[model samples]
Target chain A: MWTWFYQLASPKWFYQFSNKLLPWFRAATFILFAAGLALGLLFSPLDYQQGNTVRILYIHVPAAFLSMFVYVLMALSGGIGFIWRIKMAHIVSVSCAPIGAIFTLLALITGAIWGKPTWGTYWVWDARLTSFLILLFLYLGFMALHNAFDDRKTADRAAAILALVGLVNIPIIHFSVEWWNSLHQGATISKFEKPSMDADMLKALLTMIVAFQVYFVTVLLQRVKAEILLREKLSGWVKKLVTNQ
Target chain B: MYFQSFKEFIEMGGHGFYVWLCYGVVLSGLVSYFIYSKQLAKRNQRNLIKFYKRMDARSQLNANNQLNANNEAQ
Candidate 1:
């Protein structure tokens, strides 16, 4: 197990493997994203009241879900890197921050847009939105902490600790709707019951969610590859690779 | 198939501004990332070539100087 983990941490190995996997993710993202957009816009029936504005949910819901999901992933990656001192884990955890932050912002923006039409207001102190805003702040804090230290290792460790500590907000963000009588609507989709949504709407949302997942993997891989190259630039393999290229 | 025209698509049922803004932002973000990653790859490659060239040139200069010394000794 340890040996396998070390192999994954190896920059040369990761670079080689990711090179092969990038194309698959690229194709997956393109196809799935297109399908989601088509289904959401053309195939799905309009809402009785909200009309076309409800289409925003296709983007908003998935992005919000991914925002939290990516944070958890980042925190877990950080925890692994901190425990095992794996360089690749640190690279992944750190690279995920900006991407996760952007998605968090998107979720908030789209939510506000959805809110304006549905709730007749753009801003609210609702629990779900408030917690997500905090999640965004957490991402910013992690990015700032990572860049503050001169030493790369210290920066990684400090950011890792912050990420791990911030993982507590994930659940709070999820359950906020239930925990408080909030302005935000209850989930349309949940595990405990069948989704309370049109089948086409559910299909579109799921497609978009999968697209978001693929997009995250694709971007995270790109960022991690750049970090790996920079950190391993001094190695003999890097020298040969650079010269050969 | 959804909206009647590109014009109506832009209108987006009078919520066009918000809808288009969100779409524009998402599109721009994706485009920027693609451009940034491509530029990064190109820059890295260029720098690596320059570094290798400098190393090779320095090694050649040292070898030629060593040869000159050997000739003088001879």
Candidate 2:
């Protein structure tokens, strides 16, 4: 098991392993997204209160979930890299930044759109919304800090530290709805109890969440491969791989 | 199935604008990221190949120069 973990930490091994996994992830993402969309937009009944405007939930919920999920993933990868000095962990952390940022942006935009009809407003500075915005800025800050340093190792360390520090905001974002009397609604799916959603609606949301997660993996693999090639440009394996390509 | 016809579905019971816009933006963002990452990988490969080719050519030139200098000494 330790050997497997070390092998995964190796850039060359990761590159090869990811190459095999990417196609499957791509296929699953496509299938899940298609089914989720069909069910979410057409098959599932509209919310009795919000009507068709609730359709935005399909996209909004997944994007919001992924925004926080990716941040936590980034923070964990960054922590591993910091403690273990694993170059692959740093690469994975960096690869997740842009993807997380995009998801955060999507969540914000979709949330705003959904809010207009429901809350009669497009923007709100409530706890949930505000913390989520801060999360986005943290992602952007990580990317910017990573790029600012001329030395790769220094940049990685700096960005990893930032990610770890930003981990505090993740919990805040997750519990903001419960902790504060904000306009943002409470959780529909609780860990301790049954979800407060219809079966089909829950199915569609769950499927979309899976689709987004798979899509993140697929893209992360591609991004990590590119990062490896760039960072290991002079390495024998990279040279041979590039030549063969 | 929720809507009566294609028109109703498109209209999304009068909330079509928000619904479609949200989906459209998210889809576009995802697709663009996918395309961008693929292109970046291709570019990285090309850059690596080009760097190696240049290094190989320079080494070959140095070897040729050394051979000429050896011939001169002989």
Candidate 3:
């Protein structure tokens, strides 16, 4: 395990490994998105009360889930890098910010559009919404702090500290719907029992969720590869990637 | 497959606008990022080549200058 960890931590190994893995990830991303979208848009049944607006969940739910999932991954990587002084981990943590921010924006905008149709309003100060907005701000703040320092090591440490501090918000975002009386519905996909929705709807949502997860991995690997190249540009092996291919 | 026609599918039981808008915005965002990230990776590689070439050129110039200095001293 330590051998694997060290191998993964090596920027050169990660760049080559990701280069090999990307073709497979890209193929899976394409197939999964196609399947998920087909299942979501055409086969999934509508919510009797909300009508077609519920179909928005096919995108909204996955984007929202990715937004939070990416945040945790980012902060955790940042923390790992901070603790161990792992440069690759710092690269990963930094790569996650923009992608996570984009997903958060997607979630917020789609949620607002869905809200307008279902709840008759676009914006609300409810707990879930507010906490999630803070999440977006946190991502933006991480990037801002990271870029503020001219030295990469100083920037990584400072940004990692901010990310670790912001970990408090993740649980708050998860439980905000329940902790406060809010318009947003409590999450239904508990582990022990079948979800409260129709099987077809559940299937569509699950498929879309997996698709988005795979997509996140695909993009994350790409971004991390770019970052590795940028950081390792002066190193001998990175120059081979340029001169050879 | 659920709806009777393309037009009906597009209408999506009168909530079509929200559903399609969400998908469109989200899809476009994902697609643009996909393209942008790939381009960035390629651009980084290009930058690496440019960086090495500039370094190589500077070294060659330095070597030439050293040779001139030696010739002048001799």
Candidate 4:
């Protein structure tokens, strides 16, 4: 078990494993995105009140979901790396920052676009929106911290600590709607009891969410694989693979 | 399917601009990010290959110079 764990931690092992998985991930991401897009745009019923503006939820919700999800992963891995000094874990933290930032940006942009149609305005400094914007800043801060240090280990450690500290804001973002009188709607699928939505709409939303998650994993692997190679460039195995390929 | 035809679907009940704009931006952003990550990996690989080639050439040159030095001493 320990040997297996070590192997899992090994960058070389991860690189080879991801190489095998990349083709499959790419195919699945494409297929799922296509299905999600079709279902979201064509099949899902229009909202009675918001009409076509409801379609924005399909994109906005998934981006919002991924924004939070990626941050959790980033912070958790960063915490793990900071605590244990696992170099590969640091790589995971490093790779997750930019991806999380982009997801946050997507969520903010789509939410603003969605807002313009429903709320009659494009921007508001509401609590949920404000906290979410903070999430984006946190991601930027993490990346910026990572870049500031000339030393790899120090940079990773500093960024990891910042991520852990920012984990406090996650709950604030999640509950901001309830805590403050905000324009943002409460979650459609809250706490796994049942989605307070039509089955068809829920289906489309779930498909898109899963598709986005799969897409995230695919891209994350792409980045991690690249990071592993760059870090392992001096290793014999990487050299052999590089020259042979 | 929800709409009667392609035009209605595209129009999206007068909210077409927002819906289409959001979708277009998000999809294009996602695609561009994927492409960017792929390129980053490829660039690093190219750099590694170049690094190895440079190292190999320098070592070969050193070996050749050593052989000449040894022969001249002999």
Top TM-score: which candidate number?
3
CA RMSD (A), model 2 = 1.9
Who is ahead in TM-score, 1 or 4? 4
Provide the lDDT at B51 for model 2. Answer: 96
Q: Candidate 1 chain A, which ten residues in sequence have the lowest lDDT sum?
A: A225-234
Going through the candidates in order, what is chain B's TM-score? Answer: 0.65, 0.72, 0.78, 0.69
The docking category that best describes candidate 3 is: medium
- What order do you get sorting by TM-score, best first? 3, 2, 4, 1
- The C-alpha stretches of model 1 lying farther than 4 A from their native spots are A1-6, B1-10, B48-74
Candidate 4, residues A2-105, lDDT tens digits: the string is 88678867898878878888888889999999999999898899898999898888889999999999999998988888888887899988999899899999
Candidate 1 residue lDDT tens string, A160-199: 9999999999999888999999998888898999999988
- In candidate 1, how many clashes are counted? 0
- Per-residue lDDT of A150-201 in model 3, one digit per residue for the tens? 9999999999999999989999999998899999999879888769998889
The TM-score obtained for chain B of candidate 4 when compared with the true chain B: 0.69
The lDDT of model 1 is 0.85
Model 3 residue runs over 4 Å out of place are B64-74
| TM-score (chain A only) for the predictions, listed in order | 0.96, 0.98, 0.97, 0.97
* Model 2 lDDT tens row, A47-153: 99999998899889999999899999998999899898999999999999999999999999999999998999999899999999999999999999999999999
- Compared with the true structure, the alpha-carbon lDDT of candidate 4 equals 0.90
Clashing pairs in 1: none
Poorest stretch of ten by lDDT in candidate 2 chain A: A1-10
lDDT of 1 by residue, B1-74 (tens): 56667787667688877766776676577657755664564577667778778888999999999999999999
